[model samples]
Every structure is written in structure tokens, then in C-alpha cells.
Target chain A: MVLYLIGLGLADEQDITLKGLRAVQSCSKVYLESYTSILLVDDFKARMEALYGQPVTLAHRETVELEADEILRGAHEGNVAFLVVGDPLSATTHSDLILRARHYQAPGAEAPTPVPVKIIHNASITTALGSSGLAGYNFGQTVSIPFWTDDWRPDSWLARIGENMGLGLHTLCLSDIKVREQSIEDMSRGVLRYQPPRYMLLPQLISQLLAAAREHQVDFLDPERTLAVALCRMGAEESATRRGELVRAGTLAEMLACTEPDEAQRRQDEQDDEAFEEANPTVSEKEMDARREARRVQRAIDFWGEPLHSLV
Target chain B: MVLYLIGLGLADEQDITLKGLRAVQSCSKVYLESYTSILLVDDFKARMEALYGQPVTLAHRETVELEADEILRGAHEGNVAFLVVGDPLSATTHSDLILRARHYQAPGAEAPTPVPVKIIHNASITTALGSSGLAGYNFGQTVSIPFWTDDWRPDSWLARIGENMGLGLHTLCLSDIKVREQSIEDMSRGVLRYQPPRYMLLPQLISQLLAAAREHQVDFLDPERTLAVALCRMGAEESATRRGELVRAGTLAEMLACTEPDEAQRRQDEQDDEAFEEANPTVSEKEMDARREARRVQRAIDFWGEPLHSLV
Candidate 1:
């Protein structure tokens, strides 16, 4: 009997490695830890069950943290599989699980007996960011930005980013995800009400980042020239990468908006541009430069479809 | 027609994702890029060929660098798969390949028409280091430690490590691999003769790091207390990690030597310790403390079997 911590890669169920799939098939009980990050495909559980020929229980944060003993007991009795969205070891919580598995005591056992634990590695978003045409080796520490509430705003990640930037290194900022959270009023009244899931998009991340930048009074490159690479749904067919400046205040939304155009609008713009170019064959170099810039922006917005709609 | 740059994950053929396997099965040609790192399996090409049912070609440095046009042409005619050991984009050379593929032109084409390139990501050694029980998010910029030949020792990586240490971040040092290299004499004689392939092991890396630390005159924690975690054959069945101190000069070898134990020897040692403890039933607290320390060291030496033997 063993506890297998398997990584389900960055995208859909197809991203699971053959080794991981084999392990899942061998396991009697399988769990997909679902609160950290969302998978990119629909009917994920059904698809995974179909592929692995095994039933999978969705383990929310509470299930993992509060009912870890139950999961460990399953491993104690038979082979168990714990599936994660990205690399299994990418999160501290999973590492803690491994540690707990090592020290778990059975109900009637006199002493602690370690469970045989095995990890199946897979692609993580931190390394998958290399798809953005940025050098992965140049990236410094990865920082996460939490969704800000009225009384809970933290800017420690800002200092880490600043340190990385000062060292001429890149910083990977992991977006926040809020899931299965109860409101303060509901918690005080001993209610079991939960709020809807909220995933922090690039717009919200940018707004918080810009606010921290201003409050810290750090001097950076010119607003128009300081570029950031925004990646959405990486390792999937709908993956998109955009390199654009981090403009401050209200214009930030406008800057993000113009670059993201629907496919029909983009096609129409290309046609209109070609027609104009044919009509004005002897256009000025300055105007041609502006057209090139516009095209560059348009090309950068390659596949910002439904996934990026919330950013607007 | 498309060029699929698929990652083969860290271990063997079984580490390839289902999507990657399907893509390879559909490809007309498959080439395994075999320079940056070595796959941790025997008969790698044969195993992959068996799994994919496609004839596999080993693409060495010369084949990829000097004959990329042929690969691009293969993609232009039909789908081709270029398999990499780790994540496809982890290395700059692969990024260059992607760029070249984008800008490649057919022999008689008037302009460079971009060919669609798809990257199927997998587990890279960088992210796989999370198995060492270190937080992946705490890692700083990754640096490379090249083989230090006489009269050509570079220490720029020292500064980068120092920067990371200043920020209290872990630095990942990628070991260098020298394959298909021509010696100075061979190059001077206009010969095609090549030198034997060389991999920078932990001992050599430690030697160079200590030299850099001394030359730079940087203050570090006590040598007995300062530790380094060395990982080998990650994401494989033989993967091993050892945490030991970075002592100076001669004793460094002794420190590394004492920790690595073969299974039989480890079992024998445990039996010997038990026998001694039983003989001396009322041992002093100081002797008991030493026994505890020995057990901790022995437990930490877990699974150092065949993989870490080279570290000595």
C-alpha cells in the first residue's frame, strides 16, 4: 500500500503523464485537490474518471486540511492517489501532506508507521511561463498576490519584486484564487454560507501592483516603457501572451482593453488596414510606424478569447 | 503542418503526457534533442520508439544547430515532433529553435512565412527540485555552473548566488554538460575530432563554488553549519537528495563520503548500533545524544544508492 501524490500538469486531464495515469489506475481511492487552481477543461472529474477507470473525489481545502486523517487512513488501508492541478510538490500544503503521511498513526496502532509515499512530477505554471518567450533561468523568487479586502492588504510581495528587479531578474507573480470562503457576518452567526469563487485576473493584479508601486515611492522605468508579460491559460490551446506597458490609474484598463479584440473585429481591422495601405501606397514613414505598432499590439493579443473576458 | 516541441518529462518514456504521446504518434518524423541533459533511463530511444511506434532520430548538437533547416522542412511538409528531455522551453537553445522555426523560409519562397509551433510542456529539473522538500516559491534566479577549464574560469554565477543569498532565497545551480566538443589541438589542426563528453558532478561544482567564495571574500555562515542540498536523477526511480554542510578544503570530501551508504552496509550498521546499545544499557546522556545524531544522518542518507555514488 502506498500514497501517490501525482501531478496533473497545467491544462486538462490529457496533460497527465502515462506514469501518473498508471498510478491512478492502480489506486483504490483517488482525490483531486481542487482549491488551489482550476483546471482548464470542462467536466474535468468525469474526463479523468473516464481516462483512469477510477472514481475521483474532489478535495476542497477543508477536506484536505480537516479530514487529512481520513485520507491518510485510506492510504493506510490500500493504495491511494492524491492528484494536484500542477506539479504535486509546487505547493507547501502538498509537502505538508507528504510529511503527515510519513508520520501518520493508524487507529489501533501503538506506534507511528510511515506510509510509502511516491511523487509523480509534472509541469508547473511557474516553469510553464517560459512559453512567454522569457528566459526561465532569469526569473527570481515566485510571489503570490492575495485578493485585497477592506482591512486586509499586504504589500510584502512588492519588496520581493523590487529586489528581483533591482538585480535585473524577472519575478513571477502567481494570481490569487478565493474559494469556499465565508463572509464575516455569516461566520459570526455560525452560518455555513459560502461566497462564490473569485479568481484574480490580470487587471486586478495590475491595479494592486500599481497601487503598491505608488505607495512605496520606488522609482521605476517610464510608465510607457515598463513592460510586463501577461500569460493566460498557459499550456492550453487558448494560451495567450501579451507584452505591454504597465500604465497607471484609469488608462491601465484602456491599455488592456484595446489590445484584446475579438476574432471578427481583428479580421475586419486587418482588412481595413490592407485597403488603406493599398489606397495610400506612398504613406509617410511616421504613419507607417504607427501602423506597425498597432499590428504588433494586435499580434500580441493572439488568443485572448473567453479566458481573458473577465480581465476587461 | 506543425512542429511539435514536446517535453519528455524528467524520467523515461512513461513520463511523456498523453497529449504528447498522441502528438508523437501522429508525427511523420520524431527527433530527440540530446544535448542539454541526459534522460534517466536505459535504451531511451528504443523505449520511446516502442511507445510511439515512430522511428526516432537522435538530434545531436550538430544536427540541431547546423541542420535545423532540414527539421523545419520536415515540419513544413508534414507534422514533426522534436522531443526534449525536460520542459521544451527551459533552455535558451530551444527558444532559438522556436524563433528559427518561426522565421524559416521555404527554399523558393519570397518571404519568411511563420510555421505554427506547438509546445507541450513537462516537468523540468528546476521545478522537480520541489521534491527535495524545499518550497518551490522560495527559489531565486537559477544559475549555471560551467566546467572551469584552466585559464577560463568564470565566476559571474557567484555574484548571482550572492544576490539570492542576500534576499534569503534558494538558488538553483544547473550543472554544465560538454558534449561533442573539439579540443584546442583538434580545432587548431582543422580537425573534426571530438573530446569525450563531460558532466560537471557535485564534487567539481563544490570545488569551484568554494574557490569563488574564497576569491570573492564574502562572509558566509559557519562552514560546519552552511548546508547545500544536492539532487540527482530527479523524477526518476533512482532520484536522491542529500543535505550536508559545505566545509572548506580537504574535509569537504570526508563530509560527503560519510553520508552515502549502500543498503547492505546501512543495514549492517544499524544492527551494529543496536548491538552496542544493548551491551551498554545505561549509556550516558552524551553517548545517547551521539547515537541520535548518527541515526538522523543515517535516515537522511536514504536512497543514495547508485545515483549519488559519483558525488564522492
Candidate 2:
């Protein structure tokens, strides 16, 4: 019996490979890693359970970090499957899990046996960024943008992005996700208080990035001339209804506005889909309005689905 | 009808996702993108054909670039599945193919109609690098190492690697693969001659890297202190027989020698598999000699499998 660290690819349950699904189906216990990233769809857990025909326990950060002893014991006794969004080992936490499972390998020389862990690879947003028409090899260091507070604004990521830009390389910016976060005061007082989940939207990220640029006065990237692409619900094209969207804009502001819920619609002919307009010329006025509104809402939610931006 | 750019994940046929496999099954014609990278297995084309129950046409660089008009026309007529190893758009060639497929959208307001291309994502070596204990977020711009030639050697990739090292970021080096490369002399004569494929091995890559370091005199990465890891046949563990090996070393030079044909076998009790070593312990001297010879041959072939190296 071993610990199976499996990756559930970007979109939904069906994104799991046949090999990964087979591991989940027969494992003694199943866990869906929740804190790092979600499956980019509503009811991801339920859908995964339906596919596996087994209940899945949510593995929060604390559960996997502080209270992993129980999971390790279960793995020692029987095979246990731990599913993570994107690639299984993308997050250092999972790698730490594998390391923890091999506690004996740390200090003890030859005393205790170790619990083996097998990794099943899957598509991660890092690689999926190629869909933006930027070559993966051209991408430089990946940076994360955190939500800004009144007093705390860190611009360290700007210099890294500038370095990448200096080399004419694309930068992959991973937007921050505040999931079940606690305030510093609450943590200091030994109180565990929950805050609403927050994902950094493209608009917020771009705005913050621009602010950082202003502070740093860096010329590596230009706000008006820079070409950027944004993705939401990556790898969800096969999903029945809510197929995701990839938005490429001439500038950061344009890309941000492309997903704005209340932004005025660009003329269909002026958009990237003149061909689409040509294909559906007979669409009615009211139907077109409804479709535009629906598309706007969809784009907004999808932008809100998962936040990751790239600049080339 | 659409052009489906599907990723055949790292390794062999079963690595294709159910969604991608479904697309391939239903597509009128299937093409396996042959350049960029090949599957890390023997007879990948025949294997995929047997799995899909359809013949897979090889889409070489020249065909995909020069004669893509025919392929594009076919996609307009019916669904065309273009299979790429690792991920669909990881290579710039596929991205160019997608752009070429949309060439109709590049002209006047009333230009010819354009066909749509949908990309189905899969695990790529970029994401698969997480299998090493390094975080993907720590990787900087990926660089490629080409086979060196007299009077034509280029070392420009060293600066990028040096920049990443300066930032304390890991560099994912994509070694070059020369499949059907034409000599300049042949090209000058308007001759279309083909050369055997050549993949950069660890020894040759390390030698060139060391030479570049000496020429540039960069101090960021130490030849003796830098840690490195090598992988072959990623995403193959779930398959019944082929289990890929992850080689880790404390130094680049040590890692190079790790793949050498000859290294003393560890003592039975000291090795990872006590049983296997124990089972083979005290074999006849003649049998041991034959086993060593066979291991030398196996290492030669495995080093020839696929060409990609990772460092952190």
C-alpha cells in the first residue's frame, strides 16, 4: 500500500487521466486538495465523487500540513489517494507531504520503513498558458500578485518581471488566492477566524501591477504597448455549457476591460470574431443583446473562476 | 468542422486524455506532430494507431509549415486531429500552425471565412518538472542547448541561464533535437538531403555548459556545487512495465556520471531494492560479466531515449 498523489487537470472531473481515475477508484481513501487551487468549476467535488463513486474528503492546508499523521497512517495500512488541482506536485506543500511520508529518511539512518508515494502527472496552468499564443520557452520567472492592503504593498515582483522583460521573455503572473485566510490579529490571539475566499481578478491584478510599475518607475514593460493575454477556467473547452474564454488584448487595460461585467460591448465586427459575425448574420437584435449580456456575464465569472495572467 | 490541436501527454499512447482520445477517435483524419519532440517510446506512431484504430499521418516541420494549406483545407472540410507530444502549443510551430489556419482573418473586411482551432491540453515536460522536488514557480526562462559545430558554435543561451541563476531561479534547459536537419552545404546546392537524428546527451551538454561558463567566467552556478536532475519517459509509471527513473545529484558533473554505462553496483543491503540485489548476489562470474555488458547496452539506449534536462 502506498500514498498516491494524483493530479486532477485544469477544468473538471473528466480532466483526470484514465490512469489517475483508476487510482482514485480503487484507493482505500480519497482526498481532494482544496486550499491550493480548485477544479475551476462549480461542484467539482461532487462531480469528482460522482465519477469515482466514492466520497472525497476535502484536504485543507492545515489538514495536510498539521494533521497529516492520520492520512499517513491510513496510507501505511492501505492505499490512499490524494488528489490535487493542476499537477500533483506543482505546489510545494504536496512535495512536503511526500517528504513527510518519508520521515525516516530525514534523520534516522536505517531504523524505520518509509511510506512510498507515487505521483500521477496532469496538465497544469503553467503549461496551459501556451494557449495564449506565447511560446512556453519564452516565459521567464513566474510571479504571484497578492491583494494590497492600506499599508502593505510589496513591489518586489516588479523587478523580477522587469528582468524577464529585459530578456524579451514572457512573464507568467500567478494571481493570489486568499482561501480561508485569517487576519494577523486573529492569528496572534490564537483565534482562527475565517474570511471569504478571494481570488485576484485580472483587472485587480493589472491595476496593482500598474501601481507597482508607477512606484518602481520601470520601463521594461509599457502599459499602452505591452501585449498581454488572460485566461479563465483553463482547459474547460470540453465542458458542456460553460466553456471558458481566453482574452488577448493589445494592452493591460484592454485585457482588463475585456472581462468587465458592465463594459460596453465592442462591435461584433470589430472583435476578433468578424468571421463569427459573418457566420451568424441572421441572429435577431433581441437575441443578440441577450447573447451579448450572457457572454459578458460568462466572461466575468470565468475571469473570476481562476486568475492567471501573462505578458509577452 | 474544427482543427483540434490535442496534446498527447508525456510518454506513450495511454497518456492521452479521454477527452483528447475521444476527439481523435471522431476526427476524420489524425496527424501526429513529428517534429519538436517525439514520444519517449519505441514505435510511437504504430502504438498510437493501434490504440486509436486509425492511421496517424506524420506532420513534419516542412509539411506543417510549407504545405499546411492542404491540411487547413482538410480541416475546413472535416474535423482534423493534430496530435503533439507533451502539450499542443508548447512548440512555436504549432502556434504558427494555428495562426496559419486563421490566415483568412488577417485581411480585408470581407476576407474568406476562417476555421476554428480548439486545443486540448495535456501534461507537458514543463509541468512534469514538478516531479523533481523543485517548485515550478521557481523556474526562469527555459533555454535550449544545440549541438555545437566548428566555426558555427553559438553560446547565446548561456546569458539567459546566467540571468536566471543571478535571480536564484531554476533554469529548465531544453536540449536540442536534430531530426532531419540539413547541412548548410547541401542547402547551398539546393539539395534536399536528410541526416540521421541526433539528440544531445548529458555528457555533451554538460561539457558545452562548462565550456560556456569558462568562457563567460560566470560565478553564479558552480560546476561542482550546483544540483541537477535528469528524467526519462515521464508519465510512464502507471503503465505496467516502463517505470521512468529520476536521477538526482549534488553536482552537475556527478549527475553526468550517474548516467554513465559503468558504475559500481551498490551493496545488496545498501541499495534501494534489497531483494533484487540479494537475488542476484553471488551469481557466477561469467553471468555477472554478461549482466554488466547488458547494463552497459541498456544505458546506451536509455541515454538515447529523449533529450531534456532539468536543474534547480
lDDT of 1 by residue, A1-312 (tens): 899999999778999999999999989999999888767776788998899887889999899999999999999999999999889989888877888899999999999977888888899887677776788878888888888876999989888888888998877787787778899999999999889876666655666777888888876522454567666677765334322212122234444554566799779878887788899998887797788655653444442322321111
* lDDT of candidate 1 over B171-234, digit per residue (tens): 7877777878899989999999978776665555666777888888986522454566666667
Query: What local lDDT does model 2 show for residue A134?
Result: 77
B191-293 per-residue lDDT for model 2 (tens digits): 9998878766666677778888888998755668877776555666423444464545458778666557343554532353445457978667676556664
RMSD of each: 11.9, 10.7
Task: Indicate which candidate wins on DockQ.
Answer: 1
Clashes of each: 0, 0
Candidate 1 interface RMSD after superposing interface residues: 0.8
In model 2 chain B, which range of ten residues has the least summed lDDT?
B261-270
**Tens digits of lDDT, candidate 2, A1-312:** 789998888777877777788888879899988898876567877888898999999998899888787888788778899999888977787888888889723233466558888888888888788877777878888888788887999878888888888878888887788888999888899998888787776777788888888877877556677778776667775346554655454687677666664533565424734565578998677766666655654675565544433334
Clashing pairs in 1: none
